[model samples]
Every structure is written in structure tokens, then in C-alpha cells.
Target: MSSSAPWKQLLLNSINSNSHLKHSTYFQLATVRSNGRPSNRTVVFRGFQDGTDKIQINSDSRSCKIEDLKHCPFAEVCWYFTETWEQFRIHGRVDLIDASNSDPYKLEQREAAWFAGSVRSRLQYLGPTPGLPSLDEQPSHDSLDSSAGPVDVFCLLLLDPEQVDYLNLKSNERLAFTTARSVNAYEYIKVK
Candidate 1:
């Protein structure tokens, strides 16, 4: 947040203004498949990576998005704020942090996300692998371990934005921001 990304303030404002909405934090992430197709899914915002502008997202390692990211490592997040009638199209490369990652800081982030998630939701990661036919009629409630830590399949996604396209429909304003990975400051552009 201390670093200078031109769209940071606008995005923060949008999030703040729309925070009251139940789905305000939901954003659509689009990734290119290895087969050249596009895959998109709505993911919850897990806050930023501390003081950095990179967006934090939690994922299951068994999910297709993980495979898609493994293949391309790039994605675009389309976030809309209905309260303010604003949209931000943020495109960036994602950095994945999983159980295999040895970095201490990244590992801490993964653990933090695990604890941040609701027990009911976290139980899903501990159950049968996704994308398979349901084999059990009733997933045993006794099997859930609320006290357990994040499983090996739990992962963290950090979306480091290189460019942001912002549109404010209410004000009829549009802006674009581009920042090189080499520096914190961005080259700002006015689209209208």
C-alpha cells in the first residue's frame, strides 16, 4: 500500500465504498488454459499481501485454477463495485505459495489464510478431492477437524498487478495504469 500503483487509491476507494455488499469482495479471475482455452471463476478477496499492492487469494491445490496457473501463471481479475458503479480490470502474473514452497514469509501467509477461513469452508479442503462425482451421500461431520491446520492441498495466490484498467460508470471516467515489475511507481494514463 505504501508503494505507488496509480490505481491503488481508486481500487481501495471502490472496495471501501462497496464493503457493505455481501458479494462486494467477489472478483472474477480469468486464466488461460494449457489447451489455449480460457477459464474463469469468482473468488473471494483475501486482502492484500501486507503493505504490497498484490492481491491475496486462497485456493485448493487440486482445483483446475491451480493447474491453469501452473501452466500460465498469469491472470486478469475483473472486480466490480455496484455501490459506486465502478469496475477495475487488473491483469497480472500470479505467484503461488503452497506446501512445497520453502519461503518463510510465503508459508506464513498460507497459514494465516487457513486460519482466516471459516471452519465450515475450510472443511471442504479436508474432504474428498474436487471435480469428482460425489461418492458419499453425507460427508461425515465428525470427520471435520476444526482444530487442524491447513492441509497440503491448501495454497495461496498472490496477484501482482502490472496493469489496471479502471472505469467509473457513474462519473463517466476511465483510467489506465501501467507499472513495470522493476519499480514500485507506475506510469499513469487517462483514458478520457
Candidate 2:
């Protein structure tokens, strides 16, 4: 088997296993802050972008992470599967996929992503927005009754990975794969 086979298989397994589980898609996404520090947060793994090496994630357009990505596109994602004791660390550059983009393909993808969201998921984007302090002890969900449909705050983020490191605790093995974006090929090196 090729060196990247195990890594690819593991990643596919993780995604498949998490498909139906509500909380299984969570991963730690790290971005570079303006002060040269790293900012990390948990984000849901939407899926992989069609016909590309990019991984997809949904986000509120008003979130700080969006602003951070606008300033610095590079990011790293760390995902772990507790049941399998496997981990993947991916380094990549992010692109905001939203309605405002001039690319028709991207716009279509963004719309698809937005439509794929559940009612509860869509409601999250309609609130008082993320990262802002609320004076009220409990915010109301009355905005859900508005005539407007799902808010435009929904956005898709595509992470085009340059490198992926896979670690399997069960076998105590580590492998790193470098991806060629243009050719969609992987060259792997065993780190452990």
C-alpha cells in the first residue's frame, strides 16, 4: 500500500463515523492572531469540498474567526477520534465561501451549504450575533418568527490543506503527508 493510504483511510473513517453523531464533528481550529499568537476554537467539520483537497466548515459571517481569516488565511485544524484513538493535524489556507463572492461555483456551493443546515442550525445565525456581550440573562428566540428566512450570516469556509499529519495511538505510528494542490497528489513521510 502507498504511504498515504493509511492516513487517507483513517481520515475517511473518521468522517464516516462522525456523519450521524451530533457532536462527533468537532475539531480544534487554530488561526494566527494579529499579535502573532495562535487563536484556537472548536468548529464543526462540515465535509470536504467537491473535487478538491479542501475541507469545509460552516461559520457565522459576523464571527471573529471570519475577520481573523480575512486578515490571515493560513490555519491549522486538529481533529481527534476518541473511540479509535486516532488524530489528524492539518495545515492549510482558508477561503471564505459566501454569497458575496463573484464566482458562480462558490456561490452555488455556499447556497447548498446554507440549505443543508437544519432549522435549529439556521436559527443560530439569526440571533444577536456571535462574540458580543449580552445584557439580558437569557436571549429570546422570537426572531425565528420573522418573515425573513435563514439569515445571510451563514458562510462556508474551505480549508485547502497543504499538509496532513496522522497519528494512530493504537499502533503508535505517525505519518505526515504533503499534498500538491494543483495535482491533488499526496507524498507521505513517516514521522514515527
Candidate 3:
């Protein structure tokens, strides 16, 4: 963080800000099986917390990808920012969030907003059961219409990133940032 230059900041900001937009297509690769076989898929980049150096993703609970994650936590995410020729690669450990102890009423307004934007909530209303129809589903966007939004229920897939790499084609430069959990503290590093 101390070594980041203006160009680095600009690149990071672009990734963090635009990754979650509706149309940005990104791919995340992970070793989903215990045997270490690789699996890749296109996913929506839900959000990230720069302060915490963590990212959020969404996956259907029953998806094969989720099952693959149960056997392996390692994952790599890649996406190119539009027209910039800069590519971002994120290496991280992925996990499913446990909401068993969650207190819905205790969430702050902003937290609630995050929850609502989550794939779980956006695809399926998070009630006791999965895939419940949203009460707010207007007739215009109803299932019968082609303009309907996503309706597949999904679960929260959180990534505790271990490293991030940024490659700029214009400059032919690469920057890597890493962090790890050790002794209940975060160890940060940069590799150029």
C-alpha cells in the first residue's frame, strides 16, 4: 500500500468500482476438488472491501462449483477493465458464509443494503426456504416477461484474498499484492 503509485491507484480503483457492475464479465478459476483439478467459470463480481482486503461472490448452493469449493478453497479471479488493457488477477481462498447465527434485525442500513445486493438476495429472497419469490417483483419484470431479473436462488460465497496481481499491457508492467493471516494478524506484502 505504501508503494502504490498513481497508476496503480487508478487501476485498483477501476477494478474495485467497476467489477460489480451488471455487464462486466469476469472469470474465476479454482481448485474445487481435493485432487487439485482446475475449474473455471464466469461469475459476477459482487463486491470487495479494500480496508479488509476481501471480496464477495455468489454461487448457487447446489451448483457444482460450490461442491468443488467444499473440497478445495483455492481460487483465482481474472478480469480485464474495459478499454484499459489492464488485467486484474486475484488469488484467494473461498468459503461459504454461515448465516445460522446471523441476526437480521441487528444489521445496519448499509449492511442491509449489501445483503440486498448479494446474489442470494438478488437471485432469491433469503427467507427460511430458498428461492422464494420476491414480494417486490413487479408485473413488468415478472417471470412471464423476458425483462425479468435473475430468479435463481444463490448462496453467499466469500473470498478471503491472499494475493492480487495487476498487469498493465500499455506499460507492460505487473504488480502483485499479497496478504496472509498469521497469529491472528494480517501480514501484507508486495511483489514486483
lDDT of all predictions, in order shown? 0.84, 0.75, 0.55
For model 1 the TM-score comes to 0.90
Please name the candidate that would achieve the greatest lDDT relative to the true structure. 1
What lDDT tens digits, residue by residue, belong to model 3 across residues 1-192? Answer: 442322336445776666665445455555556566777766766555434445666555556677788788778888777656778787788766433316443223223334545243453433344433232222333223223333334456667666677777878878776554554343444444
For model 1, what is the C-alpha lDDT against the true structure?
0.84
Question: Whole-model lDDT, candidate 3?
Answer: 0.55
lDDT of 2 by residue, 73-92 (tens): 99999998876778899998
How displaced is residue 135 in candidate 2, in Å?
A: 23
**TM-score, every prediction:** 0.90, 0.82, 0.62
The TM-score obtained by model 2 is 0.82
lDDT of 1 at 79: 93
| Highest-scoring model, TM-score | 1
Clashing pairs in 3: none
Superposing all C-alpha atoms, what RMSD in Å does each candidate have to the true structure? 3.7, 4.7, 7.1
Winner of 1 and 3 under TM-score: 1
